[model samples]
Target chain A: MPAQSSPPRTDSRPGGRSARVRAAVHQAVKELLTDEAGDALTIPVIAARAGVHATTVYRRWGSVGELLADVATSRFSGDVVVPDTGSLREDLERYAYDLAKDLSDPDTLALVRAIVGTGGEGAGVCRMERQRQLEAIIEREQGRGNQVPTIERAIEALLAPLYYRAVFTDQALSPEWARTLVSHLLPR
Target chain B: MPAQSSPPRTDSRPGGRSARVRAAVHQAVKELLTDEAGDALTIPVIAARAGVHATTVYRRWGSVGELLADVATSRFSGDVVVPDTGSLREDLERYAYDLAKDLSDPDTLALVRAIVGTGGEGAGVCRMERQRQLEAIIEREQGRGNQVPTIERAIEALLAPLYYRAVFTDQALSPEWARTLVSHLLPR
Candidate 1:
């Protein structure tokens, strides 16, 4: 007799069967979001795209809004460390440029569009996540004995402009522009 | 009689009866949005709240989504002007702080929520309007001549931080923080 076969699975984690299924569903959602525009967002489409049962999608996220939020949040997060160069301006300039680069990337931009489609309802929470990231960076700088005031301000200086350019201006945040911003602000 | 008398209307606009009616409807829609959350957004509810004929709202905007977009767009605009302080850093710092204050204000926050609730369908256009305002400020600064790369960077440094703080951090753009940001980015 053939040896008992192990369950077919795709997830690399040790969370077992449900985790594997969830991982597949999550990946499918991310792909759909990346490929489609805001208007194309829907559950059946996502389920079909992921090759999962529609009920699985519903069970995982509870709603399409939540699912989109999860995809965007996951895609945009994780330990994005802030680099320090002693001078606050230089440090901040690098920080800002890197952030602009990250947000302007194709996958990230798609995630932004998805979250933005939901408008300000989810914006507050989203903003909170960003704030946490900023706070961590600032605190790290402070731990190095940097002046809190200068470093905090530098953090703002670096990031707000790129976002203003993206969300308010509808302009892509270019590396040249980032370099220009950093150069003037840091001047080192 | 010296002249035929017209009835005093709740709408203050000068026009024929239809125009007055339209104004009333618009006002009503605004009030409803201000008071209710996203889930409460609906045509019949809006019509009843506005006290204008429901058909007029539909006729003017075509659908609930369209009407909501129009209302959100019409209520907020990208028209903020940055004051010139003869120092780029100072001006930008003021601009950043003021923008945060404005965007986070109760009225503006509500408007943002309304816009976001629309699922970012109109976000691109709205962002464009905001960009025009920022560009206008930048253009005015450039008009002063003697434009330096550092000053330009200062502009982004000063402004971007506040927005990043507001939209990303979910924290109120504090005046103290603005001052610190300006000091660090601007040359002494």
Candidate 2:
């Protein structure tokens, strides 16, 4: 979990050179992952793309897998707005569809696979973000005096199937499939 | 998917030196995965342990990730005995519990994560094996004149939650949890 936290900034100044370097490195990693074969992704190649010293890149991110994990975490948390459609079913359906779409992207899928491969704090961070979003939706439903499934139940019913298909099977996820999962979770 | 098939044997003789070499290499990979840190795993190290030349290892396996994937596929398919308890509910519960217990082992979990990371044919091979087992159970239930859920539904309800918790959350899966999933799916 230590790697889940951002490393301390070498320069304490706001909007400083350290922040710039981190941003450049992350961008470089994403671009490489998208445009090149996975085998072509190495420290020197990424460093060259970012216009940073290979040692600097190596020092900042111990390995390519860790660098990919960092980028994946930022992309997962920063993007994807949680829906608030008032109805729990609608909210969940929209959320699932969005997730399915995101995972369908080759780059995003690669990032997810990389995170799974890295096998540590990265997956935990992404899971926490997902849990937080689900909790918020549940809390809102409770305030509206509507019965809703537990967050754990929601995850088991709604999220797991989508991810399982995305990662394991070649099955293409669709909006209809997303709606089906939500319906199963909250049958009318 | 090409890698999913075993490479042609250099020695066409049945139970020949090629077969022994493959066995030794697989055993060496499993022992290294169990005993050493993932970082310590390399073609040379595994070759040394297997008493095979590093070039031979590389020529056959290509990379450590692929080698790990091959071992994982063999382990996943070979070790588990699929349940056939006549009753669908009992069969599913036993299956889930066994899967949970297997994934709980650190070595097995590491192998699974490695397979996922390798991405492509390895995950497909494991999924196909699981699907085949489920199909067998469903077919047996049908033969017994009992109604059963589709393989897709079984996967969504029974397997997805187990894998999701294993890979994403730190949640410890229990026998009760496995039974609960089967209950939710069967709903008697």
Candidate 3:
């Protein structure tokens, strides 16, 4: 048989070239943020680092604030792993503690602050990721015949305080605080 | 005797010319923010508007972000009035609803976002102001012989959700939502 060579195809699927571009751009932003002061960050610098055209970066991200929000939200989405500890209280406490720890990181906190500061669309994405994780935990609890609070209640009572402290206050987020919040949410 | 004329003294007291200068600078920032795009705001422009030296503005405020944070915090401090409705639930609900309404203003929200984005000292000032208001409400409830949740609990149950939704979610902050949060915090 003659040598069969596949032609170079333009992959425009959502998870194909588009996803790759986003990953590269996000990675470039992270590297740049780490290597340089935030004041030194700009679209052209990021585009150069990512090996993408500055116009493409600008068209996709709009501004440095929006781009930072996207990168931060994506980092949260990837880093968070919802626990399946089988007990709802334990699961929530673990999740909350992990979230508190993650948010305590300076870089992560900066990203979160950027997301809120930018008031961009990334906040919704971050909220949805947390909602999905909570829903999974709630579904598991339901299957186990345990009474659970509504997702809205869980969000208000459990998630809100953690983020509130992280963003607005100088209060420390401890494991005990996470446990207390979970206890209040899943009261006996 | 020759007419005794008082010497011109530099008013450096806390609420004297120093305070006047600060007020003028903050007012200039507010007017500039309202009149121009945030990108066009700079120390020199703000100082020029305030009729102060650019070096003075720079030395005091450090950057536009800090200046915006100061303006926003001072605005909140001056604007917020803690309710005394003779009932804890009513007071909390009214306060929260008002807060939601105030935060809904585009300019106020932008100022808040800037404060968080800047990660400056203004967050501490804002938190302290809210804490003082909460303490007043708590003391009033205590004087009435009503069993009230602790200030920490009130913050977690009542205040956090409003800000959480305002900053992070697309959820509407309705009077009913505020009432619900109050009810949760102070159950009958």
Candidate 4:
């Protein structure tokens, strides 16, 4: 991991006392969302949790939806790393296995679930961000001159079963499951 | 689609007005959760919508978490159809392409986003029902007696790209996307 003097700020807006307060509020909100699970989260409650004034929350974000989206962006940070392992099959298998592990993690799962559930303005934003991540990964792999669509399809095919199992089915996330998905799904 | 029928009753106890009310309440609750996005729902609002007393909602579901899970089971009516296409690749590709189409529909996407956004309770129920569907498809393919995990993996591989694109990325659900995913992912 790159040594960070502070958490990387992707937003280009000026960083000041307000930015610091917003960051703190977002961290508090994320923690509460993870811990409380379905409990009604109010602005006052978040303000108390973050040790900030209620006005700070209102002035910076205006609504819980905006705050949640900011938190979602921070929590589900990083791009999908695309790998080049010579063959499309190897590359896809690795991508699937890695993504399965990431999606299965409780923290990532919660944030993803929240984004999926809260499908208002935030949901659309999260969906678009996720798309950007995929496009970035595709560009990286395509730079290597592997057939873009084929490689992209191969990677998606390999990862989809584990996700289907993890998110929509009851299958255990076993090495066998990953390997089977790869072996059967990957072009020989 | 199966012949339409009245919603099922939830009471077996004799001489029960409360039971009838409860049954009506749950049925209405189920529709609200499944038929719409999460943003449009609230317990008080649901009670008004169902024409049930608000106290009943608290007594039966206790929390949104429990209510959400119940809604998922009630909404999921049945499984996917897996046609025997004479070859594993054909069968897998057919299933993949069809499932992709099913998933891409607006109602299904809304349900998926809602179920995923909530928590593990709804997620678990949703996954179990889906597994039953997928397993039925797999078992039929296996019953042809040429079945292997590799075949299953390949089928999953074939379908994963469409879903990954739909769920994790913002790609348009084009016929070309479907063909690209299936052609590269499906085993010969």
Give the top-scoring candidate (lDDT). Answer: 2
- For each candidate, what is the lDDT? 0.60, 0.79, 0.78, 0.62
Predicted complex 3: DockQ: 0.49
Choose 3 or 4, whichever is better by DockQ: 3
On residues B1-188, what C-alpha lDDT tens digit does candidate 4 reach at each position?
Answer: 99569675555357476766656766665566556334345567678877987887888887666776776666555555555766655655566666677677766666665666656577677545544555565676678786454435443654445555566555566766666555554434
**For candidate 2 chain B, which ten residues in a row score worst on lDDT?**
B33-42
Candidate 4 clashes between residue pairs 3 or more apart in a chain or in different chains: A113-B117, A117-B117
TM-score of model 4 relative to the true fold? 0.69
TM-score of chain B of each: 0.67, 0.81, 0.77, 0.65
Assess each model's interface with DockQ, reporting 2 decimals per model. Answer: 0.29, 0.42, 0.49, 0.37
Model 1 chain A is weakest, by summed lDDT over 10 consecutive residues, at A117-126
True contacts kept of 4: 0.62
Compared with the true structure, the alpha-carbon lDDT of candidate 3 equals: 0.78
Please give, as one word, the docking class of candidate 1. Answer: acceptable
Name the candidate that leads on DockQ.
3
lDDT of 2 by residue, A1-188 (tens): 44657777667687588788889998887786566354435678889999999999879888776787678678878566889987887888888888888879887777676667657666776567767887888889999998879888889998789878887778999889888988888878
lDDT by residue (B1-188, candidate 3, tens digit) is 98558875678355688788899998886676555343435678889999999999988877776787678667878577889888777888888888778767777766676567666676666567777888899989898897778889888997788778888888888888888888888767
Cα lDDT of model 4 by residue, A1-188, tens digit:
97878876665457766677877897777777688656555677789989999888988777666777787676555665665666655665666566667767767666666655654456555445444544555666677786565445444645456555665554567765676566654335
Residue runs of model 4 more than 4 Å from their true location after superposition: A1-15, A41-48, A51-59, A62-65, A78-98, A120-155, A162-166, A169-188, B1-45, B79-98, B148-155, B158-166, B169-188
The TM-scores of all predictions, comma-separated, are 0.61, 0.85, 0.80, 0.69
Worst 10 residues of 3 chain A by lDDT: A32-41
- lDDT per residue for candidate 3 within A1-188, as digits (tens), equals 97558775668355688788898998887776455344435678888989999999989888876787678666767667889987888889888888788778777776776567666676776567777888888889998997878889899987799888988988889888878888878767
Clashes of 2: 0
